[model samples]
Target: MGSIDRYIFRTTLASFALVLVSLTGVIWITQALRGIDLMTSQGQTILTFLGVTSLVIPALVLVISPIALMIAISHTLNKLATDSEIIVMNAAGFSPFRLFRPFIYATCVVAVLVAFIAAYLAPDGMRRIKQWDAEITADVLTNILQPGRFAQLDQNLTIRIRERQPGGLLVGIFIDDRRDPKERVSIVADHGTVVKNEGGSFLILEDGNLERFEIDKRDPALVAFARYGFDMSKFSNQGHDVALGIRERYLWELISPPDDDPVYLQLPGQFRAELHDRFMSPIYPFAFAALTFAFLGAPRTTRQSRNFSIGSSILAVFGLRMAGFACSVMAVKSPFAPIVQYLMLLLAIGVSLWIIIGGIVIEPPASLIESINNANARLLRLFGRPATA
Candidate 1:
């Protein structure tokens, strides 16, 4: 690469990195908020909250990288145009394709990043998130250890602890259970402790009394007990052996799922769609960079502004991306639908290359420019200023 190529490559890569991080951080906060309950209500630590939330960053990057690349290329080209660097380079015998080579290099770099994340990092992160969630749900003590707050462990079960002392002692424990249709049970205990073993977890209550109310009877039956064990195993097994979603599976797994896999066997189209989507994801950065450069990187006269070109590029990129998304969705219903995604990407790349190599300059139509000028003149006249001729 020449010195000019290196300069543009560095500027574009830096801008892409900055935009990628900014966008991912903003989006991560929104997504992480949904998991805040793990800290606020579930008595989990801040580190735990961050760890679980950070696992989704790889997936977010996979989605945001291509958009960031487009923005970065546009910004770099705009800067060059505004500074007259592009005009100077063009006059110095630089072709549009030559000017775009640095951006192509940057795009290749981003494509590799996307490919790594899509094929490996994203799936691994999702798997970790799933495992973390399962562990959290199975940790019955974490769910019920919040003192002075009623922890709803199940739809019909709630537990509250007044205070917790060192050495695993709990004081003033209250339990409510209405899971049974025929009766409701409430237990008041002076002290309690949780015990776990191979059999499962148990909430052992001491110096407590149980009150049982039959649905048919008005009066309640009461029984006093010196020691009682309430089965807490049910909470741990609530979502046992849940199947992993398609997004959580590795790329190879998606391509060749086991015949016994229930989801793939039942909905084969989904697996097919996912397989193609993963393979096609890395191609977007190259296509997006090419399209943006073709639309905005060509040299234009000093009298022309590239605002229209910028807008057109944005619209075209958005349309192409949305079409790919739609194709993925359609592929879930029809096995042949994912072919459209490839076709659209290929068309974008091919058309953009043709335009760039052919020295095509995208400019606003004369009629539109005239209309804008006339509107500005009328506004100036209304404001008591002379209209430009």
Candidate 2:
């Protein structure tokens, strides 16, 4: 690569990084806000909240990278044109196709990034988030046993603690179980902690007394004990099997999901759609770059209307992406939909490359341009502002 190639490559990559980070951060903040209950309602640390929420970033990047690449390419091209660098290069025998090589290099870098995230990192992050949520929910003592409040674990059962201390210690523990119609049981303990092992989760209470009231008997039977193990496995998520969603499955798993897998058996179409979407994720950057350069890469003087070209480029890219999105959605029900997406992408790239290679300068017709200028002048006159000569 020459010095010019290096210069353009570095500039575009730097701009891509800045735009990607900025867009991802802003979007992540909006998404992370929805999970604020992890800190407020659930007894969790700030670090845990941030760590769990940050896992969604890989997915966000996968979606944002192509858009950022398009923006970077547009910015680089506009800058060159604004400074007359593109015009100078064209005069010096540098064709538009030759000038596009550096942009392709930068696009390749972003495409690789998108592919990695879509293939592994994004799904891995989603899997980790699911696991994190499972772990948090399985810790019933921390989630359900809020200090100084009675938590109705079930319609017929309630538990409360006067204070929750460090190291999973519970002070002034109380339990009311009325699940049995034949009996009403209440247990009060000075202190206790939740214990989980192969057997199941248990609320092991020390220095507690239990009083059991029989439906037939007037008086209650009281039993005082030094320690007791209260079965809480039902309330805890231990030993329960959970099915991972489509997003939580890795790429390989999606490709060859188990025949007996319940989610696969139920929503095979969705899995198919997801697989194609992931496969197409990396191609977007190249397609976007092609479309942008086709519309805006031609050497033109400042006197020519570039704003209309820029708008057309933006609209074209947006329409292409929207079509892709529609294809992905339709692929869920129709197997042929993925093929249409591929055709659309190929058609866009083919036409764009043809224009770039042919040195085609795309612009609105002179009459259309004149009409828009006259309309602008009329608006200016109506607003009592002088129109430009």
Candidate 3:
């Protein structure tokens, strides 16, 4: 690349990085909040919370990188135009395609990043997150170890512990079971420990008394035991492997799912749509950057600002992306729905490239511009201020 290309590429890269990080961080905090209960209520440490929550960043980056690149390109081009750099380049015989080369380079870089995340990193992260969540659910001690809080394992089962000792002992354990419609059982134990085995998990309580009462009868039967084994297999999610969702599967797996897989047989359209979506995701960055450049890369000598062009570009990008998303959603039901995504993207790239090469200037309609100017004049008059045409 030439020096000018390097300079523009670096500027766009810096802006893109800034916008990507800022947007991703803001969104990550909101998403991470949903997992905070793992630490606050489940007794997980801060590191565990951070580790589990950070896995979603790859997916977020894959979704937001294209939008961030578009914004960065628009910002860079606007800065150049405001300073008349683009006019100088045009006067020096620089074609619009020549000026856009640096942006295309940046788009290629972002496209590769998106492709990697979509094809590998995102699925791996999702799989890891699922495994972590399953492990957390299996660690029953973490859920019930929180003192003074009732942990509901099921709709009719609740457990509370008064305190936890250093030696993996639970003190002052209380269990309420109302799962049976005809009876209710309550148990209080002075000390207990959770034991896991091939059979299942069991809560072994020592020096505890159990009270059972029938729903129809007022009388209760009570029994005391020095040691009691309570089956807790139902409350724990261990030993059962979780099935990976379509999004959690690798690209190869999506392309060739096992014939015996019920999910594949039942929802073949969804699998096909996912495969197409992953392949098409990387091309969006280039399309968006090209569209932005076509709208704002050309030099204009008009005294009026380019706010209309900027807004139009933003609206066009948003509409095209939304259509692509809709296409993906519909592709889950109809096999041919993903074709719309390809058409939308290709059309955008083609139209933008044609406009850039033909040196066409896209401006708002004169009537609309005049209407806006007249409205601004009226508002200024109402405020007793002068308005400039």
Candidate 4:
């Protein structure tokens, strides 16, 4: 609420927002450009691509925000410190802890908001993105056949479309079926449409002829018909399996799968890793700012650059996060092997705590310690009597 606090808060927030926007723009551009092949192959529009990209922005922001805020506030503090603005505050009766209050408050706000998005919004967005991708793939595959071309649907069937009819109809259809070894059927229709039945797809011929052949002998029998219907049960989805990746599963499904699956096993590790990181992200702002402050705000006469400390802190946080990811990926592939998540957490926390606490001080400010103790402690006495053995 004070003048200096408001000044630092505004400056840091503006810088954080600038970095956040730039990062998002660059990442989205890269994603969209690299996905040109996928869009063309899958027959997805620009709007669909953008919609899918938009769903990931929340997750991206959740990833970069803690580090950005840490650097922004740390650099702001270091600039003030290196330029003797902090000395002015101290002369005006401000303590070191007093200067940290604004940073702490800002970190708390970022933490809670980022946690909400990372935990709830990010997963839901991921599901929507994957669903859209699946739809796009199916649409592309279904449109593989065009008119006036001999299109091979699969090994068992080939279709030739002579003309397109109104209202989702196909005219002049020819189908070759070669499933049975003893009998083969070839059908040609003059004016017909491909239709779908409750059981399978069928080609209804108004004026067509069916020729049946025997594989044992070179004999062909032709039947002329006014109206004939041919069954397309050959193309029925019978021995085909639709396999989707773990990224396609919902949270509950990911956690509790119906079967013992390789994909499910791999996903829990990723899910747990992400869940832990989200829970721990809010803590990054404090630890990173503290570490950078201790190193960059040390009694130095001049700053190397306007934002050196901020840049350094951001780099450090990113490095640590990547390290965590590397370990989590290994854990996902291995079975109960190399439990590295805890190690990654401890490494990050340990480095930050070491950098901050090595030279400065062990104790928090009186107000902070008092508040924490009061908020956390439980009464250990009965009838207001403190008894100890």
Candidate 5:
């Protein structure tokens, strides 16, 4: 019994690991292609980009593990059937469900690991990544302007650079800023650089021009060019200060949001959506696992189950899981939607159990077997092989 348990456990675990790694790799490659733009924009090193991308895997694994688990468990069981191990066990009077116990145990362990990542590690890592992005954005904004090109640093400010030298000096600069309606000003300079003055911070325009536009024609404009100076407001919106809602907050904080939390008010829909997602997503794994077994283990075949049950189960699981995720968006806002999702999940569970446990399919017709054999023969012939006797 101990050896059997160990064997089942090892096989199930290996299957789960294989599925997890393969799925993760697919998701990782797809995301990496898209993330390259971000990495390039921020001028991130390969290592930094990899590290940042790794931070999101916890959330991805948390999202995907259950589907992978279901597929893994189903494949393992099906493999046993193909290898005739299931037949040997049945002949020895071991109940059909006796095989699924180790898989269930493994699923439980997977659930725990998933919960930890979803609840804690992912959110923290996301926050750190966001912070780094903010820093990168600030650094870029401060120094990314090119000489002799019209550049808009931000809203209400357009700067034209004549030339920027190796000694960090900006020569022949034109600045048009309309940040303040009451005091819109424009300045042109022969040479200048952002430097700390005795007072605070000021832009010194030398040997160039300054023109302040006036609304009324009677109110004449003022132009000056003798190294005049103007104060520049260091408006900084650091990303560290901006909480990226569920991405940055801990599970507890997401569940019990603080009253003064700006994220809740600023983007209420997104906030609620993520909150509901985290809470509701766990149910999918159990739902899928049961569905897989329910669909497959039932309609058992004496020789080989040539039915489309395997393909059908895969489609059903994929469709149901996708529907659940799509519905989650609207479900979060409405109070009764979550309840409906839960009820539907429960119904699926009961259905799966009824099919698997209640001995659904029994003694399928010989014609069914002949049709399957014929189809297999055709398939083999198409691939240039002989049919079976």
Candidate 6:
């Protein structure tokens, strides 16, 4: 690569990284805020909370990277135009396609990243997070049951703890079980720890007294014990499987879902849609780069206004993405939707390539430009400042 190519390549990639990180961080913070209950209500430590929430970053980056590449391209192009570098290069016989080579190189780099995240990293993160969340929820006695508050572990069973100490120790424990119609049981204990083994979850209570009241008898039977094991097998998910959602499936899983998979059988259309979406994810960076270059790559005189070109670039990028989203949604119901989306993307890239290759300078009509100038001048006069023609 020549010096100019390397310079442009480095600049665009640096800008892409900056914009990608900034946007991903901002969006991740918003998403992490929604999971703050993990720490506040679930009594999870900050490390656990952040670790679980940070897994969503790959997914966020999968969506943000294409847009970041477009922004970086636009910034680089504008910088070149501002310094008259593009005009000088053109005068020296550099074609539009030549100027675009470095941008495409940078786009390819970002496209690979987006593809990796979409195909594997994002889904893996989602799957791990779901499993982690299930594990946390399964440890109900330690995580969900808070101190000084009565927790309804089951429909007719309530448990309370006065103080929760380190090492899974629950001090001043109380339990009221009315699950059976023929009997009611109440228990109070000085301390307890939850234990799980192959036999299942058990709450081992120490220094506890149990009272059982039978329906046939008015008086209750009371028994004091030094240690007792209360069955809590129902609260544990160790006996069951964790069902994964469509988004949690990897690309290969989506492509060749097992015939007996329950989620696939129930929502096969979603699986199809998601598979196509992942396939299309990497293509968007190329499409966005094409549109950006088509709008802003042309060399223009200093007298020309680039405001219209910039606006058009934004609109084009947004329109393409919104169309892609709509198609992905419709693909869940209609098989033709994916085809239409492919055609749409191809047409966008085709037209953009045509413009770039043909050196077509995109600009508004002269009458519209004149009207905008007049409006600006009038506003300037109102502000007591003269406007340039």
lDDT of 5 by residue, 20-77 (tens): 9999889988876776644444334677667767777777788778878887878877
lDDT of 3 by residue, 263-300 (tens): 89988888998999999999999889989998999898
The sequence of per-residue lDDT tens digits that candidate 1 reaches over residues 249-296 is 999898778989988888888889888989998999999999999899
Per-residue lDDT of model 2, residues 47-160, tens digit only: 888999999999999999999999999999999999999999999999999999999999999999998898899999998898888867656776878889999988999999
**TM-score of the candidate numbered 6?**
0.84
Give the distance in Å from residue 171's predicted Cα in candidate 5 to where it truly belongs: 17
Q: In model 5, which runs have C-alpha deviations exceeding 4 angstroms?
A: 38-42, 141-143, 146-240, 266-272, 298-302, 362-389
Q: Residue 337 of candidate 4: its Cα lDDT?
A: 29
lDDT of residue 61 for candidate 2: 96
Measured by TM-score, how close is model 1 to the native structure? 0.80
Candidate 4 local accuracy as lDDT?
A: 0.63
Better of 1 and 4 by lDDT: 1
| Candidate 3 backbone clash number | 0
Alpha-carbon shift of residue 229 in model 1 (angstroms): 12
What lDDT score goes with residue 357 in model 4? 42
- Writing each residue's lDDT as its tens digit, candidate 6 over 45-68 gives 788889999999999999999999
Report the C-alpha lDDT of model 4 over 1-389, residue by residue, as the tens digit.
88888887777777778877888778878766765544444434567667877877776777778667765776687668667887687677665656666766667677777766655676677777766655444431225445678877667667786765443355677878666778888888887654555666565787888888887778798998888876655644422354555544444554456666776555667655444455565655555565555445433345333344455555776676676667656755553423465555566657655554443432335796587666656443323566698
Sequence-dependent TM-score of model 3: 0.80
Candidate 4 ranges with C-alpha deviation above 4 Å: 38-43, 78-83, 140-150, 154-274, 303-319, 333-389
Give stretches of model 6 more than 4 Å off. 142-158, 163-172, 175-234, 377-389
How displaced is residue 267 in candidate 1, in Å? 1.6
Estimate candidate 3's RMSD in Å.
6.5
